[model samples]
Target: MTPPANAPTFLAQHGWEGAEIQPLAGDASFRRYFRVLSEGRRAVLMDAPPPHEDPRPFVAVAEWLAQAGLSAPRILARDLERGLLLLDDLGDSRLRETLDIAPEREIELYEIAVDLLVHLHRQPPMSGLRPHGLDQWLDEVSLFPDWYCPAVGLDVDGAGFRDAWTAVLRPVANDGRAPVTVLRDFHAENIMLVDGRAGVEHFGLLDFQDAVAGHAAYDLASVLEDARRDVTPSVERAMLKRYKEAAGEGERFEAAYWALAAQRNTRILGVFTRLWKRDNKPHYTNFQPRMWGLLERNLAHPALGPVRDWFDRHLSAEHRAAAWAQAA
Candidate 1:
């Protein structure tokens, strides 16, 4: 697509000039980005809908990250009203695309990612970036009945799962809490490898607009418990072990890790459902097994026994159908 005549005008007003433009490969979300290759300067241009994908959160998070000295993409220009963002080019070096590299190299690069997560998690709280908190979590978890119920086509049940979720969270929410920035999507796909070597310190981070003050283990789960790609158990274990050594497990680390993981995984399930029923894209339904894995993992946690019991009864049909339907 040719750059709009007004597009150059917008860039020129912002002190960017004379650039050759090409579209950068996009991700699963509604946002799209392009590479603006200029004279000895390259930038990424992001296009997002105002209602669905605002750049305000992304802008705030990027500024905070820059101040903290992280290797994230810097914002070059933005049209907040239009939700268009111009960013530094981090290159086409996603960890997901290059994962076939040797295991040793993979582990090395992952360690660097862990280090970055540690840095963000260690930062002090800033307003407007915290988790949607208990209220949002409650609402989010409640959606299970709305979507998972229909998908499974199961006999009706009361709000038993919600009661269990609250009962389990009451003590943890009261007793232990640590706050820090959490990049909700910190998987390999968003990371840019600088050095060809795996596990090196040189890398650029991207897609951190959703950063929020959250539990310390949230981003770690984002990396280790990745959705789009797989992280071998051995590697995930190593990454967690490294995080534990570096940060010293915060209060109820494992509990929080699994809790936030459940939250994240549920949010993804709803998103996938919306993608199919509302957005007309059904490929996301292919992630049925992975979504079930997340649900089961949360269930297996001892504290989540009540939640697990409900899922065991309700999710069985959905699980079986999801598997067999996709296979067919």
Candidate 2:
């Protein structure tokens, strides 16, 4: 794809005139990224067009992560009004790509990724971040009924679904444990394996513009129980054990981990379906089976009784398969 009309002016103003700009792979969000090469140096230009997307939150969070000694992209320059940012080129070695080439490194890579989260969780609560608690979880999961159910011809009782989620998620929202900065999309695709970096810094974080002050377990679940790729049960189990031991949270951590996993996967089901039905991005549906499997695994936990019952009553086996089959 061609760069935006103003991209040349933007680059020229930043002393990158005549730079080679090539489109980089985009994520599920509206933001677009480009790799820029000028003067034998490389940088990434983020084109977060206005109205649909904003760059300020990303700027703030990037600063926060940098201050915390994490490997977030350095903001070389920015034009928030124009929704554009020139950032340090973190390179093309995403954990996903690296793992695809060297599956043997999955455990090693995930340990580093988990250690990064463990480090973040130990830090004091971040200021200026929104809470990703009960209300947020409910609002996200509602997308399933709002978009997916209708698209799959399943008549859903939206109020009932919300109530069910509320019952299960209320304790989580009210839990006394202090919230930490949750990088809302901490998955393999969003993590770059930086060479020559030490410890957790070896993992370059991305797509964290939506970071929130939420339960630590949310990001953990986002990583281990990813929607875009299959993280083997053994790896998931090992990572969970590593996190629990490293954070020293014990059984409480286990409960929160499964609960958040259920919530995240539930929300993804709707989000993916919405991408297909509303955004015309049907490829997202391809992950429905994996999402459903993760949801089921989490819902099996006794703590998720209400949510399990809710699914049992509202989403019959056939109804569930209807959505899955659509993707297949």
Candidate 3:
């Protein structure tokens, strides 16, 4: 994937003339990133081509998060018509890679992440974002039956799947906790460990364009029960306790956490499979077992009885993680 045709013109117009452009990364979406080295300055160029991609939401959320005192990337320049953006480079030290290299920093780093959520929840959610509640949850989990089941040779009951999810998630949607800004993709891989920044600022947020006004526990569950990496049971427990204590949440939060974790993991199971089958990104299959592990743990919660029972009857262990073992 080369940079957009007019990326140089876009960069030059923004004073990044003749900068060295190097491919950085492309995420699950159509967006591609490039590192720009101009003179002594460094920046990241976002190529979010039109029709299939848009930069407006990203710009809106990034600006909103910055205004709310979070470390979202600064938008230096943008050409929304062409779906291009030049942003302050948040650097290369991702929390996921950092943890892989230094597992010892797990507790310390995760605490800071939890604290950032604690602080974020204290603020009013950004206005005009989509609501993520029972309806959204039901729709998201539908991906499992719609994609995953068919991919693995199971013709599971779609109605039963939706009903089971509705039973478990309806309460969560009405849990009465105030909504917070949910960085929908909050996870280790999307976090940057910035240098010279202390406290929560050390964690530069990314991939948050799809943020919505949603349950506070949603993002907590997202980070603690990460889909891409293993978070030790003890560490997960510690962080859950830390968030509950800091956020003044109790039993309801715990229940919501598990329920939402299962919802997220289930959705990701289908999503990763879709990425493989429909999108031709076969590498995502490698995360299926990990997703199954996380989902099974979430299903173990007593409150998720209906959802768990649905899975138990429909998907056997061999059809669950074992089905993906070879792919992993």
Candidate 4:
């Protein structure tokens, strides 16, 4: 494969002249990653181009996670002006891949992830982060009408959708409880299970530049209600119980969990659809049915009354089935 245009110059400038660079798997963003080998030393390079992506947030969040004693990749060298970062190579054993090979280890891996979240929530909020509040939630869900709905040949009242969601989320947003550091994309794909590290340090975090001050339950929902894979009901129940006991937030936490799960699932439906329709990455549509199942399960909770009612009235089961079929 041809090397990136800037890789040679960037590596040379960093004293990694003639290093071997191999492409690593990329996610749903414009950023690309490469594994660099120089003098038997391995590190990862992130290429985030300007006018499309920025690396500042990733750098800042990495520092914060390290200060909090977590396992974020260590930055070795960076050129933010050109959006290149040389980072510690955290290995290739993603938790999802490990679970795929050893299905029985699902419970163990998920437990470790939950424990990490419990530790994170226990820490005081990180300063200078934006809140993932009502507006952000609505902005995400609006994609349903703007992109997903159209892709499926259905018309939705976008304004009405926002108004209804506002009513559903206002109580939680105005509860006066301070927000926690929410790693917005905490899931199997972004979490690595490193060898030889004890406890939470064994879990390597990724794609957390989108971190924000949000309800603790939001990340909990992201993990248990994962869009990429099936999480058994038994595992979900156990993890929730463990988190409740560890965090000591009780019923309020439970309520918020379901609410955020509902919101996250709703937004994901739109996001996956947008990925297929706008980004030309059609594979995301394969997860729509799983996402829809998770959304329905979360909407079952009484705390999601308004949002559930809106779905029932506007997007019926028949419509959902038709939309899924069309998108798939």
Off by over 4 Å in 1: 1-6, 14-18, 27-29, 155-158, 195-201, 317-328
Predicted model with the maximum lDDT:
3
lDDT digits (tens) for residues 67-93 of candidate 4: 998999999899899888999889999
Cα RMSD for candidate 2?
Answer: 1.3
The positional error of residue 268 in candidate 2, measured at the CA in angstroms, is 0.6
Q: What TM-score would every model get versus the actual structure?
A: 0.87, 0.97, 0.98, 0.96
Instruction: Mark the regions of model 4 whose C-alpha exceeds 4 Å error after superposition.
Output: none
User: lDDT tens digits, residues 6-52, model 2?
Assistant: 99899999899999999986767788999999889999999999989
lDDT of each: 0.71, 0.88, 0.91, 0.86
Residues 136-159 of candidate 1 have per-residue lDDT tens digits of: 666776665666555545544647
The stretch of ten residues in a row with the least summed lDDT in candidate 1 is 319-328
Q: Give the residue spans of candidate 2 off by over 4 A.
A: none
Model 1, TM vs. native: 0.87
For model 4, what is the C-alpha lDDT against the true structure? Answer: 0.86
lDDT by residue (48-81, candidate 3, tens digit) is: 9989998999999999988888899999998999
Local lDDT at 211 for model 3: 95
